[model samples]
Target: MKKFRYIVCLLSLATLSSCDSILDKGPLDAFTNDNFWTGEGNVSGYANTFYEQFLGYGNAGGSGDFYFNSLSDDQVGRDFDQYPNNKGVPSSSTTWRNGWIEVRRANIMIEKVSQMTTLDDAARNHWLGVARLMRAWQYYKLVRMYGNVQWVEKSLDITDEGVLYGARDDRDMVMDRVLDDLNFATQNVKDVASKTTWNRSMANAMKAEVCLYEGTFRKYRKSEDSQKAPDGAGATKFLTACKEACAAVMAKGYSLNTSYQGNYNSIDLSKNPEMILYKAYKEGLLMHSLIAYICSSTQISGMSKNAFESYLFTDGKPLALTALNKTDKAPMVDGHLSLKDILAVRDKRLSQTIDGVLLYNGRGYTRYNVGMESTASSGYGICKYDNPAIPEGFRNNTTKNYTHAPLFWLSVVYLNYAEACAELGAITNDDLNKSINLLKDRAGLPRITTAIGFSDPANNHGVSDLIWEIRRERRCELMFDNNVRYWDLVRWHQLDKLDNSKNPDILRGANVANDMSGCKADKVGEYIDGSKASIRAYDKKYYLYPIPSGQIALNPQLAPNNPGWE
Candidate 1:
């Protein structure tokens, strides 16, 4: 439950008023009626409503969409919760992030579609599958945000006190139900040959992600649970499912798009191979201002220097190897080496993902206007998702501009496949070509030989060389999308990077004294002393957001709000 109380409360009041006085009503909300799901177009249109609320397209970098990465070491944002000072600000209201409303809406669609005789069983099931997938994704987010949220499979009436004010379901129970939704979606969703819309492939992509998250999360956060649930999920069971799910996706034939930058910054990705699913933006129709956030003088958000340097060198070596720093000339602009120099000689993604100008596929791209109010909060500016082609006239309004945003792509599937295999130590040489090598091929870096991959320079994740690099690839690959970095950190139990007390590594940006100048201290956060910069506080309870007090006030079953949140 997040800030959705007022909407639900108002609807309940209206229903009660209508029940009390038969003639007091104006026109009631028409969408609630059974006849709405009558036809293919109408049912499809109803399904499309959830698309508007989908977690794709990065949500335009606002406080409302509130990038969860702001809490992780990967990003810095305008929100106080994102600051590095020793403070804990768990959201006071979990109702705002609630998925119950959406779940109810989805359930309505599923219920109405079930009764419709106009459409054939297959057709009806397709719409139902869509609803199921949406519901599952929504519930997954809810469960992730607030553990053991109220699970509603069927739409409940306002008067149904038992289910309306129900006890929160066990997270394991909720996730199992979520998996059931996913299974139904996979069985019923028609296999379409396009990436623009959801289909079996899209559902499979979501399944892979869900399974991966659940597997890794359960593995790392076992401490949160006193006893393992009846469900057989553990490190092995879920990881196997995760690996198989990715294989299912690969069997669908999604390959990496040749240009990684194009995957993020392109105006059109309708035909891109790596693009498994994306939100299209036609000017004056459905567009967004994501680019405006990126091109800003001081981008509202910043990627950490840790995240920035995580990109391996152009020679397929990590920055941890100082030998690469010694012999390999870090590319320099002018005589002096700026942070951009690290980018110039590092992995091609460096040029594609961060600071200054990059020339990719003969297109000249520029970002981080140095003269403006400091480029990035962490010194290293995040230039991802910037579309240079957008006209200046429309840049101010995100709606009027047409910049297609990536939601799901095969590159993630690639990372997923590699990570799962690496996690299980089942990675064969052939698996490399199918997974990590595809990404390496795209980046034009050397493919991992057993000798080079297993060599020294262990990453801070404390995993094996291959697994660490696999994770590093994932971190750099999906940094700005979907708060994947935060999820990854949480799952890997590597929040140590975010622990400012033990080490000041992530708290500080690129350079303590150099990078954060002229920018507002609030935006840049507290760059205390000459060494530590971003000093964010983290408590174990911060892992799960606390359920809102108002919610608990309505239903006491949601009591003992997540460990530290109270």
Candidate 2:
């Protein structure tokens, strides 16, 4: 379709009387396909739809029930009915879980933009890449959540029952299409932009994450009836893709922020180079519940002691090996072993990520002894995303503080590259400097070397001690972020570690509360015993979520839910 320049000439007295010809001019109120898509601004405006639809913000509203950082072993929420606990889930409803609705919107934009003859090749390709990037992101999230789903590429007729109620595509086939979309996006998207915008950096980051997830997810959880295109037990191919994608972004010169907490709790994102992509929030225009969540009395989702125990000793050795190894920390203000001692001897990230004290009305209230029982039951004060400046203020008053939430950062790219290479058995010391060492430096821990790894061995990962440490770095650095630790457990087939039946000690932590005066050492113990917390246990069936019962009813093609989900 060749676009012609549309020039509107206002009607005058002479032309007004000639109403027959005057009505032929373009209408001033609305745009038809002929008039729209004739300028860059319109096309760009259409592409902007993906941002608000697919992305989320700091303390944002619609991210219901998915504080991924909170629902796993590392962080525990008081609401025991959330995911992995296997309660409070929908029995059936395809409402939007598979993301077909979002895909339909993106495909319309892609198709409309492609048909615009007014757009130059560069403009068209760039816009297309943006659309594809979003499409790939949505599909990846869907597949991860629902296994395989109906793959739709274009807007469909509502009355067309066959297309609307069709059988689902295989997960591997859909993911291959997802990768193809990502590949196109990486090659064509813009390289420089605001942290909130999509670009090649985001594309590569998605590729690194998606490919590595697919690779590990396939290796750890595949069944006899799974997608067979990317066949075999090894995750080498996708891991290689993950490694190269991460390296490509690293080449763009993003580095770790010196202050571990610098990337978060900011009013703006202009200065954080480490955040390759983030959700920008402007106070009054687009603020969220981050402040509310941190300060609310209902803030039950607190960090777990497992997370605190995961941090390495200051000397880069595991606390498991240090003097702090299960040694009762200094008796609490209440005369029980508590977190106070660990804060002093552990890596610098401990205090930065968790809170030990709160300043209230110019007086300091300790997290352990103070009356914060309503906020956290296990005595772990989750202060990671708290407004760093407002310690005394809880449930922050609607103030002018802008909280920019991070989505993707360079450290993830580094970790992704390092782990993928490690999985391939091709990582080296130079690779460590390029990837893991950067995080070690940020955490003020010693760097890894062949000699260092052998001298001080890691407790997990048969691959190598270095690989285990790399995994540990990821666990600590990305802790409380939710998906990283939980997903890593899935891909590494380590969810069994969460099982109290097999690992009876999985749920133990310091159970401290009010009035420290009479508190004895015997008063402190595990928050939930093995008999009561049955939901924390994991089995092979938990590897993949069940295809919703509602979805199967809508189309029986989805029946015979994933392994144990039935």
Candidate 3:
């Protein structure tokens, strides 16, 4: 018989509902220590719940934390007045508080699982390895948005008097906590079936991500005193950690997807060798956010044109005036170049990362979702995770009906690898060959020599080339995963570029219409919205999100706004 244990007092807004009160909840009478450690299947089932929690952590109903929308570079809603401006109140901040709460649950689980001593050494280690990894996973998210944050080693008992009050820790300390957990897991965890399982490879891949962010952030902005610039040597050391972690995964046999499209094709995802680890969304297990493009009129109010048009034509045709381009006006050439042609002679990844082709009746053709027409736009939604054969209208909205949401994947591993290589100035032909070859092979294109640097110094790409190449690939490879243009700008110290005081043209837009074939042509690119209405630049202080106002009021130490808010 299957036994169960209910943990009361779950933490985090996006975490699993454990128990209403940690102390109030009683352990299952069916099984205590005597029967808990009996089988592999039982232990594995518990691990599975951790995976499901990643989706519930985010706001699917568009109400909770709304972190997804806050990351949008497309448009801001008037309904939530402050967040549009990036000003959030702590008391009202679900994402802010939930993140901390979520990490605590992970810590608690790790503690509980470790204490189940009935298992042998190997089995015990396996569970411990995953717990360590989950600890790292939870911290990685916290560090990313909040910068320096609080770290807890054990689960807090909500019923305890001390549970209600906690203080934030220094950023470096939090990072150290992440590293501690990752390093321990890497050493103890055994290999598993694939990235899909709660396995060792996924944990290591996560370490690579955290290391890169810390190293880069510390190197670039390292000020002995808060206002000073980062030291040079720090950058080198950080990149070293990033490179080693990426190479470790590469040695473990991870590679990029053969086709740029293969990385995302719903049918191809489970088998994607390039993905280190990703969350599984069974038929009834997840929520679909891909509906944003479901239909222009009839489809759910999804698919923002602002987000869609950011994708440039693969052949260097700039969709955004701020982006790089070859032509002056829209449709400068015939039929707004086909997806294959736009990607011509450029990096093979352009097609692999975005919705570059259309599939119909088991055959792929040139049909594309034109932004202006709800019918045509709905004709082909992003194939990233959708089952192609499932008729067009079945599960297109956010009613929790069309279940599927991926938390992570191996593509991130490859991207992280690419970033490290480019930073080290050691982007060897072998490196490019490995990365691009995987993509080209999938696109059915002939692989070329990796000698051509997308940021070749000979091409006068300069240091900016490295930044552009990595960031561009990131945008193309990970578009609509609830991440895109805006944050990249913030990370690269390019937030100033968004400032209207200096670069008024960055936010410029144009009025255009579609051709008969369902593609919009930029007749004349113009900047209709100016500094007053449309933003050209961002305030440096806004780089780190505001420490929700309500949070500060509750705990003086906890609520100090990120640098600029006051």
* Best prediction by lDDT: 1
- Once fitted onto the true fold, the runs of candidate 2 whose alpha carbons sit more than 4 angstroms away are 1-36, 53-69, 81-91, 94-98, 159-162, 222-234, 323-328, 333-341, 357-375, 388-395, 398-401, 450-463, 504-506, 511-534
Give RMSD to native, each candidate: 6.0, 8.6, 7.5
Superposed by TM-score, candidate 2 places the C-alpha of residue 532 at a distance from the truth, in angstroms, of: 6.3
- Candidate 1 lDDT by residue in tens digits, 1-566: 43246547744643333222222233445444644555786677567667766544534434212233466666655443432222443334424344566777788778888999899988988888998999998888887767777788787765566886778878877887888898899888888887777688888888888878777777666464322332334566667877887787899877677788888767788888888788776776666666665555434556565565677777777666634662222233442224455555677876776665221111212443222232455445566666657666565454455667677778888888887777776788788887888788878677884334444454666667777777877877777777677767766766556665565445445442332332333322333121224445555665676676766766677787766655
Q: What lDDT score belongs to each candidate, Candidate 1 first?
A: 0.64, 0.63, 0.50
Rank all candidate structures by their lDDT, best first, as comma-separated numbers.
1, 2, 3
- In candidate 3, stretches whose alpha carbon ends up further than 4 angstroms from where it belongs are 1-16, 19-43, 56-85, 158-167, 222-238, 282-292, 296-325, 328-388, 395-407, 425-427, 436-464, 482-487, 498-533
TM-score attained by model 2: 0.82
Off-target runs (Cα >4 Å) in candidate 1 are 1-32, 58-69, 78-97, 224-233, 326-341, 357-374, 396-400, 449-458, 511-534
Which 10 residues in a row give candidate 1 its minimum summed lDDT?
A: 357-366
lDDT of 3 by residue, 326-383 (tens): 3322332343323444434334444443344322112222323322233222112243
Worst 10 residues of 3 by lDDT: 1-10
Q: Is candidate 1 or candidate 2 better by TM-score?
A: 1
